[model samples]
Target chain A: MQRYFVNADPSAEITLPSEAAHHLLKVMRAGIGTKVELVLADHCVYLATVSVTEPAAKLKIIQKLLSNSELPVSVTLACGIPKTKEKPELIVQKSTELGADKIVFFEAARSISHWQGSKQKRKIERLQKIAESAAEQSHRNKIPLVEYCKSLDALISDYPATKRVVAWEESAKQGETSALAHQFNGLQAGDSMLAVFGPEGGLTETEITKMNNAGIEAVGLGPRILRTETAPLYFMAAISYAMELS
Target chain B: MQRYFVNADPSAEITLPSEAAHHLLKVMRAGIGTKVELVLADHCVYLATVSVTEPAAKLKIIQKLLSNSELPVSVTLACGIPKTKEKPELIVQKSTELGADKIVFFEAARSISHWQGSKQKRKIERLQKIAESAAEQSHRNKIPLVEYCKSLDALISDYPATKRVVAWEESAKQGETSALAHQFNGLQAGDSMLAVFGPEGGLTETEITKMNNAGIEAVGLGPRILRTETAPLYFMAAISYAMELS
Candidate 1:
């Protein structure tokens, strides 16, 4: 069954947006009396039956399905803006599927690409759309939000979590085995975590110092050097391992 | 420093091949006295100095670098062949970076795309290249091999390991907890493990039953549904967490 996210409270009937209507009506060829899973404002999955169609799509609510696929911990991924256009998009799409709560792209010291003016909004909108689709495909309870931060400092200041950590390559080089797991083990349910990652050239000393000052512990993913896009996914998976698997 | 894999035994002096020579000279712009790390046939990391510049790239042994970046327990990822060309390539590349010992792509019941006569060779070659590049970039001690298995039976019969597990969606749907960690706890060093994953549409009940008959345990990754590419990565990170971090 196809799924769509609608920003409305759990009610009797709901209508999908134009894009989702097209996808359900044309792409999926859903007709009258078609059953689909719909997520409303309460972030709950409900079984809905198609009532009306054509230009606009309307659905009548059946019984709500008791589904819970959200991560126990709210994970916010703060990544340094990578050089390529595709890296952030890929990161957002994959992380959304992997159960990221939020994703923030911050401008780092060594970041080559900068989003300014209308480019920032357009890029974030495209990434947000990708996240929405990925969330539906993964059957996530909530769609991960995609946003941009002005700088590393602004990111730290804006999103303050219960636990904050940075994925430091130097930690892996120094053979710090238990830092990441230790950080993850300290997290509890409903406790938010903010994990920072570097770009292509990696985070500089000054950036690390600032984050350290803000009480963010530097942690290692593993011994191998993951690329800018790969590190966040690794972190996300490791988080899932700690909270969900273990 | 750049890293290269050389298929030579431990010796005093070694000359790089023509392809490596061109990559060092033209691509990396290595001078006569440039230092680079090489993983020889012994699978040991050794630092070497460029000795000769003419004809071919030659290097003299300086000293061995104490770099053991591999996972403690070997991980073999048996993935169902994905639909797109980019997916397998991405899987190989990312899994190599995450410390996979080997990657096997098997033809699954849900697989929509098939690797035909010459396309199989081309696809394997491309994925192999991706694995090699990812290995070098991640500073891995050994390059993970990319292989193909004709069927699930071939996969089960050929790849024998100490522990065999499958990432089953139904297990996750049943809210099973810590199946991967439970398997990881029983593993020892030098004990290889094989983890199976499904394609986009996912594994059928009959295929799961076949694996079960062959002593393959079905394990859930997490609560959320993971994409075909993301499942293996979650397995890799979970293994790393169990062996290296915890």
Candidate 2:
């Protein structure tokens, strides 16, 4: 069954937006009485059937399904904006599947690509679409938000969490293995965690120092040196394994 | 400093292979005394310096670095061949970075792309190069081998491990969360683990039943529905977290 995120009252008819309407009617070739899952304004999954498909795509709700796929603790991934276009897209897509609540890209000292002005808005919009699609394909209850942070300092200040950690290769080099597990173990239900990651060249020493000063602990993903795009995905998977599977 | 996998005696002068020589001498513009880490036939990392770059790139071992980046448990990821060209490449690159010992792609019942005859050899060779490069970039002690299997039966029967588990979405739906953790915890040092994952459309019930009859246990990665490419990377990271970090 297809899943769409729509904001509408469950008591009323749900009309998909233009893009989603095109997708359902044209791309998927869904006709009237075609059953699909809709995530309503309350972010709950409901079984719905296509009722009107000519002028606009509309569906009628059957009943609320007792389904919740969100992680128990919300996870926010703050990554340094990578140089290539593909890295951010990969990060948003994979992290959303791994149960990230929000994905933020910040301009670090070593960042080569800067999304500024209108470009920033366009980039975030595109990545947000990718997140929504991935969330639906992964059967997630909610779509992860994609945002942009101007700098590392702003990221640290704007996103306050119950626990915060910066992934540092130096920490792994120093064999500090317990910090990430320690942080995961300390979390309670509904607690939020903000994990910061570096870009291609990785976060500079000054950036690490600044994060260290802000009371954010430096933790290692593991011993192997993961690339900029791979680290946050690793963190997201580790978190899921810790909180969900284990 | 760069890292390369070389097969030579640590007590003698080491000659770089043709590709590594070109990468070090031309691409990286390495000069005399340019230090690099080399993994010898013994699979141990040694600090080496460029002693001669005339006929062939040659280096002298300075000392052993006492570095070990391999996982305590060797992981073999056997995946159903995906349709897109990029999925296999992504799986090879990212899984190597996360410390996979070997990666196998087998033709599942629902596999869209089939690598038959000579195409299979060429594809494996290309993917092998990607694994080697990713291994070097991630500072891994060993490059994960890329292999192709004719069928799922060959994958299950040939590559024997101390433990075997298939990633099944139905297992997750049935609330089988403890199986994966139980398998991970049961693994001891130097034990090998074989994890099987389906392709895009997923494995058929017959395939799952065959594996079940072969005594391979079904395990869930997590609650979310991960794509074929994303599941192996998740397993790699989760294993690293369970065995290496925590």
Candidate 3:
């Protein structure tokens, strides 16, 4: 069954958006009486039957499905803006599928790409589309938000979690093995975490010092090196395994 | 430092291949005394210095780096061939970076894309290139091999591991919380695991039955529904966290 994320409350009757309506009626060829999953603003999954498909897609509530596949602990990934455009797109799409609550692209000392005034909104819009589609495909309860930060300073000051850490290369180089797992082990349900990653070149000493001052601990992913985009996905998976699967 | 994979003996000093030489000298623009890391056929990282950079790049070994980033347990990922061409390439590239030893593409019952005679070989070659590049970029000791199986039957009969498991949706649907982490926890050093995943449409009931009969355990990744490519990366990261980092 096709799924759509709507901004209306679950109890309210709402028409599907234009893009979603086209997808349901034309792309999916959903007909009258076709059942689909709808995620309303309340983040509840409801089964709705298609009432009308001619003018625009309309649905009537059938029954609520008892389905919840979200992570117990919400994860907000704070990544340094990478050198290329494709990296951020890939990060948002894949991370949304892996159950991220939010993704913020912050400019680091080594960051080569910068999102200026108008370009920032357009970039976030494009990435948010990717996140929305990925959320639908993955059957997520909430669509992850994609935003940009002008600098690491702004990102560190804005986002605060129960636990905060950076994926530091020096940590791995110095053989800091249990820090990541230890932090993850202490997380409880409803707790959120913010993980910081570097760009293509990697995080500098000054950046590490700043994070240290902000009370963000440095954690190593593993012995092997991971690319800028790969590190966040690694963190997502590790967090899921530790908090949800373990 | 630049890294390259050479299929030469560990003790022997081998000349860099033409392609690798061009990449080192022309693309990277390395100096005559530039130091680089090379992975030999023995899967050992060796520190080598450029002896000559005139026409072709030449390097002489100095000493072994004594750095090993491989997972304690050998991993063989048996993934169903995904629909798009880019997905398999992405899986191979990312999994190689995450330290997968081998990657096999099998034809699942729900697979949309089929690899024919010449197409299979071409796909394997293309994915092999991706794995090689990713291995070098991630500073891996070995390049993960990319291969294909004709059917699920062939995949089951061919590869045997100390422990065999399938990433089943039912396990995730039932919310089997401890299955994946327990499986990882039970693994010992040098133990090899073969993990199977479904295609886009997912594995059928009959296929699951067949694997269960073959002593392959079915385990869920997490609560959320992961895409065909995302699931395997999650498995890789979890394994790294459990065996490498923890």
Candidate 4:
């Protein structure tokens, strides 16, 4: 069954948003009695059926299903805005599939592209849509939010978690292999983690110093030099393997 | 410093391959005395400097550097051919970065796209180039080979490993979480692993049954559903975490 994120309370009849209705009715060609999964506002998956489609596409809730496809510890990936437009899109899509709770693109000292004014809002909206689709495809109960942080300072101040770490390339260069595992070992269920990554040129020394002072320890993904976009996905997967699978 | 994979013995002077020469001379604008890291035929990183740029670029090896950026256990990803062209490219590139030793695409029962005759050779050549570039960017000692197997039987017979597993969605649905870790725990350093994945429609029941009979264990990545391309990368990352990082 196809899944859609519906923003409403559990009721007898539920109307899907316009975009989802268009996808169900026109794109998927779903008709009356077609079954689907709707993730309502409570972040729960509910079995639903297409009941009415004349005025608007409405689904009748059948029953709530016991589905939990989220990470034990919430992960918030704060990335330094990469140079190309496709990097953020790739990060959001892949990280969401890997079970990220939130994705934030922050302006780093070495960042080339800056998300400003209405461009920031438009980009966030587009990325949020990508996250939603990815979440549905991955059968995730929660759709990860996409946001933009104006600077490293704003990111440090805003997203506080039980644990904070920066994916620093120098850490790997210095052979600091155990910091990431150490961080993972300390995480408990329901604890949130904030992982920061740099852009193309990578994070500046001053930025690293500031983050270090703010209690964000620097860790490495592995020995290989990962590109700006690949590091976060690696971190997400490693965390999932450590916490969920292992 | 720029890195290039040169298929030559560790000699005092080494002539760069045509493609690497063009990239070093034209793309990087490297001149005499420019430092570079070359992974010679012995699977070792050598510090080299540009010695000649006339006719063909040449480099003089200074000294061998101690570097090992590979997973402790060798990993071979055997994926069922994906539908779109981009998914294979993405899988090849990302898996190479994540330390895959080899990547093979086999025709699955549900595969929509088929690679035949010269088309197969051409597609493999293009994907091999992608793997090479990704390997260099990730500073890998060995460039992972990109291959196409005609069928699943061919994949099973051609590449024998110490451990063989398949990423099956049914295993995840059934909550088989410990199987992957169990496989990883059984692996020793220098041991090779073959991980198989299905395509868009996924592997047929017959294919799964055949693998099971062959003693290839079915392992679940996690509760979330990964796309045909995402599952192999997830397996690669998980193995690296289990064997290399943790």
Candidate 5:
């Protein structure tokens, strides 16, 4: 069944939103009596069936499902805005599927591209849409929010979590393998984590020192050198494996 | 320093391949005495210096560096060919960075597109180049091979391994969380693993039965519904985390 995020409270009938209605009626070609899944504002999945069509599309709620696909620990991925537009899109789409609570793009000391003024807003909005579509496609209960920060200072001050770490290539080069596993060991259910990644050229030593001063430990993903965009996805998958599977 | 994979054995003087020579001498603008890392055919990293660049660029091997980025267990990813060209390319590139040893594309019952005749040869060759480039970019010692198989039966018969698992959505829907973990627990160092992933529409019942009969186990990556391209990547990252980190 197709899934869509809805904002309204649970009721006997739901008048589908204009965009979702068009997608269901036209794109998916769903007719009256077609079944679909709606994730309400409460982050709960509800089964619904189309009951009315002509003037407006309406769905009758069948029942609420016992599904819970969200990760146990909330994860926020803060990345330095990469050089190319496609990198952020790939990061948002893949990380959403891997179960992220939020994604933040901040300009770092080594950042080459600046997301300024209206471009920042448009980029975040576009990435937010990508997250929403990916969440629906992955059957996620929550859609992750996409945000931007002007500087690493803003990202560090704004998105504090129970545990914080940065994906540092230097750590990998130094053969520091267990720091990430150690961080995962300390996480509890409902705890939040913030993982920061560098841009293409990588984080500067001064930036690393600042983050270290702020109590953000540096950890390596593994031995291989993952690209800036690949690092966050690897982190997400590793998190899922640690918390969900094992 | 930039890294390149070479096909020659370690010698006092080694001539760089035309492509690697072009990248070093032209693209990178390297003069004599420029230092770079080279991975020889023995899957070892050697620090080398540019010696001559007139007729053919040659490097003088300085010393061997103690570095290994390969997974403890060899992994072979056999995927049902997806519809889009970008998917196979993404899988090849990302999985190479994630430490896959080999990648095979096979036609499944629900596959919308087919790879036949000269097109198949060209597609596999292009994907192979992608894997090689990704390996170099990730600073890996070995480049993963990309090949194509005709069917699931050929995939099973041709690629035997110490353990095998298929990423099945039904297993995920049924809340089979620990199967993948159990499989990872059984893998030993130097052991080989083969993981199969379905295409967009997923594997048919008949294909699943054939694999089951062949002693391949079905395992769920996690609770989330990952796309065809995303599933192999999740598998790769999970394996890396299991063997390398925790």
Candidate 6:
């Protein structure tokens, strides 16, 4: 059954948002008695059926299903804003499928394109939509949030987690293989992690120093040099494998 | 320094391939004395400097660099050919960066598109170019090959490995978590792994049964539905984490 995220409390009947209702009614051709999964305000999946569709799409909740498809430790991926438009979109879509809790694009020292004023809001809205669709497709119970950070300092200050690490290319170059796994080992259930990544030219030395001072350990993904966009997805998969699968 | 894969043997002087020469000379504006890393026939990274730019670009080998960016265990991704043209391209490029040794596209029962005759050759050629470029970008010593398997049976027969597994969604739905880690644990260094994935509609029950009978274990990536392209990349990153980083 197709899944849609709604913000209503657990009740006998709930009305879906306009976008989701349109998707269910026209796009998916869902009619009366059509079954679907609704992730309501509590971030829980509920079995639902189309009860009414004339005024608006109202779903009648049958029973709450025991579905939890999130990572044990919440992962917030703070990436340095990449040069191209497609890189952020790719990062958001793929990382959502890989089970990211939050995706934040921060302006780095070498960032070419800057999202300012109206552009920032518009970009976030578009990326948020991508995340919602990806989460539904991946059967995730919760949709990951997409946001923007002003700078490295602001990102670090705002999103403090139990564990903070940076995916530094120099760390991989130096063959520091154990740092990432060590961070993974240190985490317990319900702990959140903040992983930082750089843009095309990579993080500057000053930025690295600042992050290091802020207690963010620099770690490497592997020996190969992953592009600005590929590193975060690699981090997400590795964490899932370590914490969830292993 | 830019890296290029060449078919030449390690020597004092070697001529660059036409494509590499054009990229080095025109695109990058590299001239005499420009440094480049060349992965020659021996699959070793050699530090070379441009010796001539006339007629055809030539480079003089300085010394072999001690660089090995591949995973300890070889990974061969056998994917059921995806529908759109971009998915295969994305898979090849990203998987190459993540350290895949070889990538094969096979025709699955549920596969929508079929690569036939001249079209097959052309598609493989285009994807191979993508792999080569991605390898260079990722600083991989070996360029992963892109090939087409006529069918799943052909893929199984041609590529025999120490371990063979398939990324099955039903396995995840059934809550089979440890199967993938178990497979990874059984692998030793220098061992080769063949991981198969389904296309959009996913592998049919009959196809899964055949693989099971052939002793290919079905492993779940996680409790999520990965798209045709995302599944292989997840498998690649997981293997890299288990075998290389961890």
Candidate 3: give the clashing pairs: none
Query: What ordering of candidates by lDDT runs from best to worst?
Result: 5, 6, 2, 4, 1, 3
- Give the runs in model 2 whose Cα sits over 4 Å from its true position: none
Which candidate's DockQ is highest?
Answer: 2
Q: Rank by DockQ, descending?
A: 2, 5, 6, 3, 1, 4
How well is each residue in A1-246 modelled by candidate 2, as lDDT tens digits?
Answer: 788899788998789989888988889998999999988889899999999987888898898998888899999999999999999999999999999999999999989999999999999999999999999899998999999999887998899999999999999999899999999999988999999999988888999999999988999988999999999999999999999889
RMSD of each: 1.0, 0.9, 1.2, 0.9, 1.0, 0.9
Native A-B interface contacts kept, per candidate:
0.86, 0.89, 0.89, 0.65, 0.84, 0.81
Q: Tell me the whole-model lDDT of each prediction, alpha carbons only.
A: 0.91, 0.93, 0.90, 0.93, 0.94, 0.94
Model 1 lDDT, residue A118, Cα = 100
Better of 1 and 5 by DockQ: 5
Please give, for residues A103-160, the per-residue lDDT of candidate 3 as tens digits: 9999889888888889889999999999999999999999999989998889889999
| Positional deviation of residue B155's Cα in model 5 after best superposition, in angstroms | 0.6
List candidate 3 segments past 4 Å from native.
Answer: none
Cα lDDT, model 1, residue A25: 93
Write model 1 residue lDDT over A81-164, tens digit each, in one string: 999998998999999988999999999999999988899999999999999999999998899999999998799889999999
Q: Best lDDT goes to which candidate?
A: 5
Provide i-RMS per model in Å.
Answer: 0.9, 0.6, 0.9, 0.8, 0.6, 0.6
- How does each model score on TM-score? 0.98, 0.99, 0.98, 0.99, 0.99, 0.99
Candidate 5: chain B TM-score against the reference chain B: 0.98
| Tens digit of per-residue lDDT, candidate 6, span A89-196 | 999999999999999999999999999999999999999999999999999988999999999989988999999999999999998889999999999999999999
Residue-level lDDT for A113 in candidate 2 = 95
Q: What level of docking quality does candidate 2 show?
A: high
| Candidate 6, B78-121: lDDT as tens digits | 99989999999999999999999999999999999999999999
Q: Write the per-residue lDDT of candidate 3 for residues B1-246, one digit (tens) a residue.
A: 789999898777568888888888889988788899999988899999999876666789998998898998999999999999989988999999899999999989989999989999999998999998899988899899899999999999999998999999888888688877878889999899999999998899999999999999999988788889999999999999989877
lDDT of 3 at A165: 94
